[model samples]
Target: MDIRPLRCRDFRILMTSGVVTMFGSFITIVAVPYQIMRLTDSYLAVGAIGVVELVPMVLGGLWGGALADAMDRRRVIVLCEIGMAVLAAGLLVNALLPDPAFWPLYICAGGIAALDGLQRPSLNALIPRLMKRDEMAAANAIQGMRWQIGSIAGPALGGLLVTQVGIAAAYAVDLATFVVSFVLLAWLRPAPAPPGAERPSIKGIVVGVRYAFSRQELMGTYVVDIAAMFFAMPMALFPFVADDLRSPSSLGLFYAATSVGALAISLTSGWVRHVHRHGTAVLIAAGVWGAAVVGFGLASDVATALVFLVVAGAADMVSGLFRQTMWNQTIPDELRGRLAGIELLSFSIGPTLGQMRAGGMAAAIGLRGSIVSGGLLCVGACGALARVLPRFTAYDERTSPHGRAETTEPVQPADPGQL
Candidate 1:
């Protein structure tokens, strides 16, 4: 299995867009919570904003996936990007107002989150069309790297900009990035819509959901991911941990440590081509992740917690690479958009619900206890998933049941109007 770098022109464009978008997104992540806190001075209201965003995000991905299957994916992505840009500009204007009401912010957050939901699936679907079959893992690794960078950079940068300048300045930066992303997307060629697709409707969404669940392997993967995220995720209680173990200022360091760990793994992912049994690798990674979470929960000092976080992040990066490759290769091209959407929805549910659960658990049992319980549950969940889906756990990447070759040569750039 030969792995190629994303040296293709369109892939380069997409990668550049990712860089800009991630930087801008980080700004918003920081600015939104800060602004909301400044306005209401209530932790409850700030927390409510997260819930407000999650609803639209899940729905948007579902609907967007259906639309991507029905229409040209490039068009779907471009439209979403444009909508995102408009929303960012609106946020900028709202920030400038003498007394920006909370309702408008909520509305904007929901809209942006919804648009992001659509953007993610469409983007994932488009990647396979951009690259060859064999390149999926490598492409996903690169994509993972982009996200790792964004996750690390976005929050810290947002905090700096918000603290030094203002929320408006951070938003302005986000708006600029949206524009750049849109321009790059515009330059890319369109991808073929899922064949035999009709107009977008509720029925179409249903069809997509059915198609996604029809596959045992894909369904199994979603189940495993959901279990991991729902039980192991401790992000919501990070603030509490920071307060307990260190100053608020040191919170960003923990985030950076996680990102650095993920980045280190992704940078060396080229060596991953040597691994024959991706499924086994995924399970090992998941187990390690669970152990790291347990360690993190018990850590009394910031350094110990950070060490656990880095390990968790590294394990997560490896799992993500294999999982994404499995998804891209297993699904048919026609169902890619819809399946990707369903997958995205499943992905969102676990983390969102987990965060909410973490918050409540922390309040009830103390941060360390809540985290420890979550970690234990995570290990149990993974074990349950493996036991229930033994066939899926034994699946090997060397042989795909799908008609397409298990591996293929690199893909060439498509004509702009081919889709």
Candidate 2:
């Protein structure tokens, strides 16, 4: 809503690049699953996609964060874009094979996931360098909007492309997006490592982990999100919920409901810039997300269920905006990437495990029961967390030491070893 951040040339370039790449990335996301289903026709094989990408994604995120801090962040982003483009080309070629190799699909998917992990930390960590600290919420909101566009339109268009044209066409589009992203990223100013920054290593990563845990506020962000996602994220149960509602055809609507809500929030996020008690804001928003999920679970009809999902989605966007602002406002620039990497894992691991949890619980209980219970657990977890970490709940941007220190000295304690 606040368009002030868009005035910066580099930020504009970066955001435009993100919009293009995310759109393409989502296209490939839909295409890959459809291709895999066509080739194997096994639910187990389709499920294995997550398993295949897991380890590589985790390692890539941690190491990528280290890499972002060690070298030029811009260079890291550019190189990863190139790598992803090559992977997309591979997907395109494989899709055109006389008998497309199933293994290559998995291979390419895993490879692309790794490149995504590698690229994101640098991408996120570079934001503060491009915008004034006070503009972080607007910047984060714009980025969220960019992602929502991809999530909503990319799949719709990709489905049409795959169904009407071919899988190869979808991959070709994804590859083109990477090319465009690379060009835009090339225009970004250099974001070099701090003078005393150490090369990326196992030790450096451990130091980053240690620093994150040492700060209660940072640790609170990670754990609270993990709890919220692990319990309340119920995407894995959408199909079952759709069936229960007797509107299996409306499955896509169920998926889109949350995105629609989140997009609405992103489009009208001007008010977020005024709220400085980020920790409290996150807690409230996450709790609302959980409550909405519970409402969704209790809804017996498709329309009611969708309304709850929309509310849940809007709440999630609010939490994400505040969480990101907290990170950017307080984190020292030198260690931003590594912290972002840990931040990545905290958010990523939750949804992955949440899907697994949803399925397991759905099997153990009825569909509605799983959704209801998870939502209750998510809400309860937030309350418990607030009680346990009072400092996090009380965090105020105006008076917090981290925020003050970041404003006064943008560069400090460059060496992880010294921490």
Candidate 3:
């Protein structure tokens, strides 16, 4: 196969299961918001539900890393998948109730968030263990492709199912996909804990955090992502923006537009494998993302705004690919799970906080003002990070200490003519 990572037996199985689970997760992403809206008829209610899950998710992910380092990664993922499925079933039962209440959703959301926190690190850590180091860039690109497609199609499909078949049916679809993912998970052989790995404990978690903090280049990745998401994530303000654009019906389009751009970038990602300066690439892509978000805020028309959003998504995908490559190429297998936990925090918590920030900004100045100011701040923050962490900007995979050492060719008898 041209895709080198997929040639490995383990990565393929994990990718299949992960992709399926991703689609299922996206369905819930839509279903939860729609359910909240139906239950309370308030945007505040919809937003609050996300808040409920944020803390548990953050904690679960970090702690899960400790467990992953101490246990079999495959087992951790499978168990988390089971936990998530059970939680989804709970939501389904609640929806079926004659008088569906809002409270149970909070509990379910928290539970699922915790499971997600635990599962993601193990899965991410599994990729490097499953594939060759040099093949990591392509593998990351493929993962980006799957994620972009799932983000785009999942919400669109979820909206369709909820509107036509009802919320219960949507939940049923999510639950079914979980079963499929579980079966796929079962097909993979055990990915056991690394040799000399410490037992899961608070001290273990602390060590992971300290190691992550010790790496300046890695810190750059995490902090830059957080700044970009926190300042420029505009999802919370999309509905208001859509109304202003006089296309209230195009809310779904707004939500899916970024993924469209991301998908486009992913399909033609062969060039990334040849790039040696991964950290520089990450900084550049993150800059582009910030600029695009700024453009999105300033655009008056729906067409222009959608165009900006697409650019932002494409930029974000590029940034993500480089970051994942760095992680896969550099990290020791023993530290992989713990580091993945920190990575999860950057991507997940940033957006959660971003949504909250977007809401506040929208209320403070105006919808457009929020978008423009946030985007501008994102650009500034990223620029500052780049300046403050020059080490990351100068990091070239060709010279990176963390990169795998090159294998020397065995000497053979000189050509007869040369001899």
Tens digit per residue, CA lDDT, model 1, 100-153 = 767777888899999999888888887877677677888888888888889887
Please tell me which predicted candidate would have the highest lDDT against the true structure.
2
lDDT of 3 at 329: 84
Candidate 1: C-alpha RMSD to true structure equals 2.8
Question: How many clashes does each candidate structure show, in the order listed?
Answer: 1, 0, 1
lDDT of each: 0.80, 0.89, 0.84
lDDT (tens digit, per residue) of candidate 2 on 33-148: 89999999999888899898887888899999999889878778888888999989999999998999889988988998898889899999888887788899999999999989
| Greater-lDDT candidate between 1 and 3 | 3
Q: For candidate 3, give the lDDT of residue 240.
A: 87
List the candidates' TM-scores in order: 0.93, 0.96, 0.93
- TM-score ranking of the models: 2, 3, 1
Which ten contiguous residues of candidate 3 have the minimum total lDDT?
410-419
Clashes of 3: 1
Which regions in candidate 1 have their CA more than 4 angstroms from the true location?
1-3, 403-419
Query: How accurate locally is residue 222 in candidate 1, as Cα lDDT from 0 to 100?
Result: 77
